[model samples]
Target: MHNIMIICPDQSPLKESEKWLSRYGFHVNTSATIEQANRYYEWSEFHLLLIDQDSIASLENASSLLPSHLRRIVLDARPSLSTGVDSMAQGAIYYLPLPTDSETVLKHVVNALEQHDDTPQTDEATPSQQSDEDAFTLGTASSGIIGQCAPMQALFSDMRKIAGTDVTVLIRGESGTGKELVAKALHNLSHRHNQPIISVNCAAIPDNLIESELFGHEKGAFTGASTSHDGLIYAADKGTLFLDEIGELPLEAQARLLRVLQEGEIRKVGATQSTKVNIRLVTATHRDLIAMVRQGLFREDLYYRLYVMELLLPPLRDRGDDISVLSQMLLEKACQKHKRPIYHYNRAFDKAIRSHHWPGNVRELENAIERAVILSPPERVEAANLKLASHQSSTQQGTATLTQQGKTFTGTTLDDYLKYFVQTHQSTMTETQLAQSLGISRKSLWERRQKLEIAKK
Candidate 1:
């Protein structure tokens, strides 16, 4: 059994977590202040320390009283990016946002203990040092992109291979998968790293203004042309120009862009002379450019010109454990942005996140987490806090209504519904099918089965 100490001013909030930890066969002790925590540390060898944010200053002063090998996790009731950074700077293994459920606290404690067990004990080596090393092994830390999965690893490998070349590259991904980041990475790795990378969102510009925006306009180009203006393309001379949502570009602008790629020149609006320029082009879009070309919505020549090299970014649902890692990272970012207390989600929230398809990808996930962080009460976030049910499919929404013995049961509690549904369906449906119908993972289904004592047929 591992021993843990929690240092906080109030004990009420943590009592539930303490009880859960004890029930799981771990010994837990709570201290109302840093002085009491110091005395407890001196009395017994502790595997981990859960320090409250308020007690951090006092704990810092009493740091010399603790050993280097003792694992420490800071729990913040009012979490901000700065406080979390300070805790980590002081050698904390984890910084938990408050309003976290007991299950989340338990998981963090167990993971911290496991990390302690794995660390090679020495006078110089520490868990934080190992964490830093582990971060590099993920392979895209320097690129400002986070992914440990095989698809992302392959994408990173491809990116490295192509980043050095000046070839026109096209990035394809669902919105919010960070295509712009990939485009920036390509620019940074290329020879044009020192040059400016002008980014333009094609869809954001009006149809009439897009042509003038991409290819500079003369003084008398059109209505409201008060003065001659250099387009974004001219600004990117001898550098990289990234056009996001390229499929949204008007056909007229597409023709102008194609000329720049082929002839290496741009003719400003209302100008008779073409100016010679050298620039690397990188474009990204969530639309199907080929389909647009066929539909006459986009120019085929330009589509072929921009499709020289393609980078396909996988959606969040396909990244497996990356979702969990990203959630924590995004949670911290949201907390930091809003200057709110760090918060954590319960097991139900985690389950909801994993089960959701995340149609909008990482962008949607970030927004959801940010909303939860702002709206949720201190320390813990429940599944309802995420409001994922509103985004669920019609089939998933219908799961609440059950038909049994020629009667419809819609008023049953979640436990009553789960018990009835599983027992009624297990005889006919496969486990995977059952899980799918219930809109949850097989692991969650199994856990519910165990919790409610509903055996499979």
Candidate 2:
């Protein structure tokens, strides 16, 4: 029989859980506190430890007291996405939300035990596992997503529910937050994995030819049309079409797109016949399409069709310690790609990453980590080596620096501040660098420049 220990402050659920486990033939013990649990732990070796939300400082604190052989599961009396992330970050084998079915609890316990039994034992922590308490880990990397933070876990849960269906998904987030990766994950996990997942960046296509690029064009359809060509929608038949920055799509194209979504058919440019296509549509945008709709820049009907199911990706800064976790993964990949020696980071590195507000999100973080790997002298990477935007300027405070005229920043709009800052720094910094420093995506910076009418130097 698998042995178990439960540390709980409440009595009712404790008794209820104990009765349920007993019925399943588990060897069980109970304690009211971590101190009491420690005493109980000294007497009997437990295969698993169940701790309620109230008893421990945090899951990390509970993890410190247990020996490596003893696995853990967390019981959240009040469940929320953040608490679930905290549970996984602390290395809990499973997380059980409150009001969970007793049989569900039993099932999780058995699965945890079986996994623990299957895993090979090691006497000491490996180099990768040796780290400070705040370091994040992606224990669920098999899902093809990298974050173990609460928001990411919540997104992962939502993705699993909808991946099997053919419903249209609109992914909304700031640029560099992995909107494309989320789209790809949905396609890979869906029924059309064998087919090509065609991607089109709406902003990159010229307004004059976007129609022909999205819908196939017959020969001599336009000035340069020498041969018939299939558009992204046609190429993506029997597969998925990922439209990145869909908000930038022309209003004319939006009308056509709405028709395609409504009728599941496409008409080629200069062609009398329309062809039927079986395609799964997934679109993502960093822009506010709703606001654009209000401005008459995007079609309301098209927006509604794409927004049937929405996935809002959280920014990197809001994901807590996931920065550290993603840093390690990116560092490993970068090292391999660049032919550099593997380098571990110091706690100071972890501290710096956790403290900085990642404005550029995952994309910016990946670039910084890769640069550190390339520049460091085969030594352990430190905070300074990463060169994060938060440390970009010694004199600048927060997201923007004070102007030379000493204008009061409190009264200024964010757009004004961003425009002023970019104008001041554009001569010395590239647009990409300037965007990173401002904590906005490059595309956002470009839009800001257009609205403010700032001339590119």
Clashes per candidate, residues 3 or more apart or on different chains: 12, 0
When summed lDDT is taken over every stretch of 10 residues in candidate 1, the lowest stretch is: 133-142
Residue pair clashes in candidate 2: none
Candidate 2 structure, TM-score to reference: 0.63
Q: Lowest summed lDDT over 10 consecutive residues: which window, candidate 2?
A: 131-140
Local accuracy by lDDT, each model: 0.75, 0.75
Residue by residue across 1-457, what tens digits does model 2's lDDT show?
7778888876536546887797789878888888777764662366788878777754456656666555788887664444555666667766665556787678668767765473434447665455421242334344446664557767876887798899999999877888888888888878897899999988656668899999989999888999999899999999999998888788888888987999999998999999999999999987777878898888888888999899989999997656665776677778889888766655677787787777777877888888777777876776677887435453254444454556544323466677778777788997679889999887787757544546554
Candidate 1, superposed: residue stretches over 4 Å from native:
1-142, 393-457
Residue 127 displacement in candidate 1 (angstroms) = 28
